[model samples]
Target chain A: MQQIDASAIDAVGIPRLLLMEHAGLAVVRAVHHLVPDPSAPLVICCGTGWNGGDGLAAARHLHERGHPLRVAVTGPLDRLREEPAAYARILRGLGVAPVECLTAEALGPLDEWLAECRLVIDALLGIGARGAVREPAASMIERINRSGKPVVAVDIPSGLDADTGRIQGVAVRATMTVTFGLAKRGCLLAEGPAHTGTLVVDPITIPRRLLETAAA
Target chain B: MSIHSSLRTPTGVTASLRNVLKRFERVRHLMTQGAWPEGRSVYGLPKIKQVKLKVRKAAAKEKEEAPAEAPATGAAPSSSSS
Candidate 1:
C-alpha cells in the first residue's frame, strides 16, 4: 500500500486545516442527513494528525450546532503532532471531553459507548495511516464494525489506502464516506467500496479552476 | 464519470478543490436564502458580512432567493416544501 504524508499537501498550495474544515463540515452534513436527529447520540472515533483534526472539527461544528457528541481518542492525545493538537484543544474547550482510550483496558467503555450511540464516526486511521492497526485503534475498529451502527468515515476508511483500496489488518467499515476534494482512486476500487459505503466527495475551498489546472 | 464506474476522474488535487469550494458556496447560499425553512439554524449560520437573521423555522420564508442555478443539478439543494 502506498503511504501519503499530509505535508505533501503543501505542494498543492492549499492550507491543510482548510481542507479539514471542509471535510468536517461535509461529514457533519452527511451524518445529519443519515441520523434521525442532529442531537442523536454519537460516538466519534479519532486518531492523531489531520484525520483526527477532521474528526475534532466535526465535533466542534456539531457542538457549535448544539449536537450531542462524545469523542473517543483512540491514540494518546500527546501522540498528536502540531496542527492536530491545536484542534484537539478546541474539542476540549467545547466540553467534548475526549476519552484517551489508547488500550483495550482503557477502552472498556467503548463497547458501552457504542451500544448507547446512534452513529459512529471513523476518523481513526485516515489516508496518512499505514501498516497494521496497533492495539486500541484496531479493537475499536472491530467494535465499531461489529456494533452495526452506521459509521461516517472521514477521508478514506481508516486503515484503507488513499491510492490503493487495500486494508492493513482491521479497518472501520463505513456506511458513508465524506472524502475531501476529489474521490480518491482507492475508494473507486474494490477494497475501497467494500469498506466505504455511500462515497461523498466534499471538496474544500480550493478553486475548481485551480484543480483543473493541476490535472492539465 | 459515474460513482460505480471507476473511469478515474482526475482527482488531481485541483479537481477536488473545485468540488469542495462549490459545495461550501452552496451551503453558504442555502444558509442565506433560508433553505432550512424553519430558520432554526445550527448556529455559525453562513454569513455574508453583517447580515445575520436568526429566523425560527416557523418564521422562515419557503422560497429562498437563490443565486442563478448552475447546470449541476446534482449539487442543487432539495426543496422540502410541497
Candidate 2:
C-alpha cells in the first residue's frame, strides 16, 4: 500500500494535497449519508498527521455547508505535519477555531464537545502511526468511546495497528469507518472488525493501476 | 554377486558412476563420514571423493545397440503376429 501511494505521488505525478482533499470530501459524504440533518452538531478529533489534515479538511467542508461542528486537535498546531498543518492553517483562515489539546489535562474540553455532538469523526491516527496510544490522544479516545455517540473513523481507528489490528492500549469503537484506498490489514484482523463496526472502503481517487498493483 | 546385480541398469549393465556430486550431496557425505565439524558453516567446504566417469567408446555403444536392436526386432514379430 505504501508502494502504491508513493508511486501515485512520485511516479504518477498526483499531488498529495489532491489525495488529501479527496479524502476529506469522502469523509464529508459519509457524514452526510449517516446524518442527513445539516444542523446536527459533530465533533472531529484530529491528530498531527495526514489523517488529522483529512479531519481538518472535513471540518472546513462541514462548516461551509453550515453544519454545527467542533474540531479538537490532539496536539498543538505547531506539532502538526506539513500536510495536516496546511489544513489547520486553512481552518484558521476561515475563522474556525479548533481546540488544541496539548496536554492530557487540556483534553477536558473534549468531553463537552463529545457529549453534545451527534457524531464523532476519529482522525487522531493513520496507518503510519506505531506503538501504543500515548497521553492526550489516549484520554481523548477514552472519552469518545465512553460518549456512546456514533463515530466515523477516517482511516483506521486510533490506537489500532494498521498492519496488525492489535490495540496497544485503547482504541475507538467506531460506528462506521471510511477507510481510504483499501481496507487496512488491521481492519480485518484481531479486534479490528469489532471496533470498526460498518466498514466502508473509500478509494479517495488513488490511481486504478496503483491499487491493482498493490492488490496483486 | 547380489550386490553387484543390484547396481545393474535396465539394459543389464553396471550403473555408470557420476564424475561429481552436488554440493548438498557432498555435505551429506561429509556429515556421514563425521568429517564435518560442529558449528562449522556449510559454505566453502573441502572437496570429497570424486570418481572419474568412464566415457563409453565405440565398443560400449555397439554393445548397448545390440541389445536394444534385438528387443525391437523381437517385439515387432510378436506384435505383428498378434
Candidate 3:
C-alpha cells in the first residue's frame, strides 16, 4: 500500500495534498451518511501523521458545511510531518485552531467536549503504527472509547496491527472505520472486526491503473 | 384564408409527437445501457437503487463470542510531570 501511494505521488505525479483532500472528502461523506445532521457538533481527534492530515482536511470540509466541530490533537502540532503540518497550517489560517491534548490535564475538557458532540473522528493512527501504543495517544484512545459516543476511525484503528489484527497495547473501538484505497487485512481478522464496527473502503485520487500495477 | 386554415396544426402536432417519441427512445436506450434513469426535473434526480451485501453468519457468531479484553498493558501510561 505504501509502495502504491509513493508511486502514485512520484511516478504518477498525483500530488499528496490532492490525495489527502480526496481522503478527507470521502471521510466527510461517510460521516454525513451516518449522522446526516450538518448542525450537529463533531469532534475530530488527530495525531501527527498522514492519518491526522486526513482528519485536519475533513475538519475544514465539515466546518465549511456549517457543522459545529472542534479538532483535538494527540501530540504537539510542531511534531506533525510535512503534509499534516501543511494541513494544520491551513486549519489555523481558517480560524479553526486544533486543541492540543497531550497531557492528562489538557485532556480534562475532552469528556465535556465529547458530551456535546454527536460523534468523534479518530485520525490518531494509521497502518504505519506498530508495537505497543505510547504515551498521550494511548490515554486519548481510552478517553474516546469511554466517551460512549460513536467513533469513526481513519484507516485502521490506532494501535491495531494492519496485517495481524493484533492490538498493540490499545486500539480504538470505532463504530465505523473509513479506510482509503483498499481494505486492510487487519480490519477483517481476529480482534480487528470487533473494533472496526462497520468498514468503509473509500477511494483516494490514485488512478485505478496505477493501483493495478502495484498488484501485478 | 381563415386564421385556423393558415395555422399548420397537423404538422406541428406530428413534429412534437416525434420529438417526444425520440426522447422516450433515448431514455430507453440509456436504461438498457445500465444508466440510472434521471428524473425529468432540472435537478436530474436519480432513481433509488438498492444494494444488498451478504453477511457472514459464522463470523457474526464468532464476533459475539469474542471477549472485549483490555489492552496488554491493562493501564494507560501516566503523564510525565511537566
Candidate 4:
C-alpha cells in the first residue's frame, strides 16, 4: 500500500499533501455521520507520522465545520515528520497548538481529558507501523479505549497489523475505521473485526489503474 | 519446472495453468502502463487554501474570546500529580 502511494505520488504526479487532505476530509465525513452535533468536542490523538498528518488535517476541517476540537500529539511538535509537521504548523498558525504528551507524566491528564470528548480520532499509527507499540503510545491507546468514547481510527486501528490483523500489544478499539484507498487484508481477518467496530474505505486521489496494478 | 507425471492430474494441471496465466495478465497490466488510460488529475481536493484560512481565522477568534471566559470546563480532573 505504501508502494502504491509512492507510485501515485512519483509516477502519477499526485502531491502527498493532497492525498493527506483527502484522507482527512474522509475522516471528517465519517465523524459527522457518527456525531451529528456540530458543537460536540472531538479529540484527535496524533503520532509523528503521516497518519498524524491525516488527523491534523481532519482537525482543521472539523474545526471549520464548527466541531469543538483538541489535538493531542504523542510526541513533541518538533519531532513530527515533514507532511505532519506542515499540517501541525498550519494548525498552530490557526492558534490550535497541539498538546504534547510523550511521557507517562504528560499523559496523566489525557484520560480525564478524553472522558469529556464526544469522539476520539486515533491517528497514532498506520500501515507502516510494526512490532509492539512502545511507551506513551501504548499508554495513550489504553487511555483512549478506557475513555469509552466513540473512536474513529485513521487507516487501520493504531496498534493492529495492517496485513495480518494481529494486535501489537495494546490496540485502540475503534467505533469506526476510515481507511484510505483499499481496505487492508488485516482489517478483514483475525482480530480486526473485533477491534474495528465499523470500517470505511476512503478514496484517495490515486488512479484506479494504479491500484489495480498494485493489486494485480 | 518439469511436472512429475505422478503428481499431475490432467484437469488440475490445465486449471492451474489457466489461473496462472490470468494472474500474469493482471500483473503485466500493472507493470506496463501501455494499457492504462491517462489524463486524470491526481489532486482531487478543492479550495484547500481557503479552508485553511477559515480554520485559522476561527481559531484566532476563539483565542480572542478565551481570555474573557473562565477556562472551558467539563474535563475530568487532572492527574498530573500521579
lDDT of each: 0.73, 0.83, 0.81, 0.82
Q: How far off is each candidate at the interface, as Cα RMSD in Å?
A: 14.1, 18.6, 19.7, 12.2
Chain A only: give the TM-score of model 1. 0.89
Query: Can you give the DockQ of every candidate in the order shown?
Result: 0.01, 0.01, 0.01, 0.01
Which TM-score values does chain B get in all models? 0.20, 0.38, 0.21, 0.22
Residue A41 lDDT in candidate 3: 95
Candidate 1 chain A least-lDDT 10 residues:
A1-10
Give one digit per residue, the lDDT tens place, for model 4 in B1-78. 899998777775454345333222332333364542342222221221111124678888998998756444422345
Question: What is the Å distance of residue B36 in model 4 from its true position?
Answer: 31
TM-score of each: 0.67, 0.71, 0.71, 0.72
Q: Write the per-residue lDDT of candidate 3 for residues A1-216, one digit (tens) a residue.
A: 777788889988988999999999988988998899999999999988889999998999999888888899888999988888888898899889998888766788888888899999999989988789986888889988999999899988888988777899999999999988876767765588789888887768788886556444
RMSD of each: 20.0, 19.8, 25.0, 28.4
- Tens digits of per-residue lDDT for model 1, B1-82: 4475565556574443443343334444564666734423223334433333455653544433233334355355554332
- Which parts of model 1 are misplaced by more than 4 Å? A1-14, A213-216, B1-82
Q: Model 4 - which docking category?
A: incorrect
What would the per-residue lDDT of candidate 2 be over residues A81-168, giving only the tens digit for each residue? Answer: 7888888888888888888888899887788888888999999988888898998889989999999999999989998998767896
Per-residue alpha-carbon lDDT of candidate 3 for residues B20-61, written as tens digits (9 for 90 to 100): 332223434455667633422112223433243446887887
Candidate 1's TM-score: 0.67
Worst 10 residues of 2 chain A by lDDT: A182-191
On a 0 to 100 scale, what is the lDDT of residue A130 in model 2?
86
Number of the candidate with higher lDDT, 2 or 4: 2
Tell me the deviation in Å of residue A183 in model 3.
0.4
lDDT of 1 by residue, A1-216 (tens): 111223325555666677677778888898888985766889888887678888988888887877777798877888777767777888888777777986878888889889999999889877767678888888888999999999999888887876666788887889999986566655754477778888787646656655444334
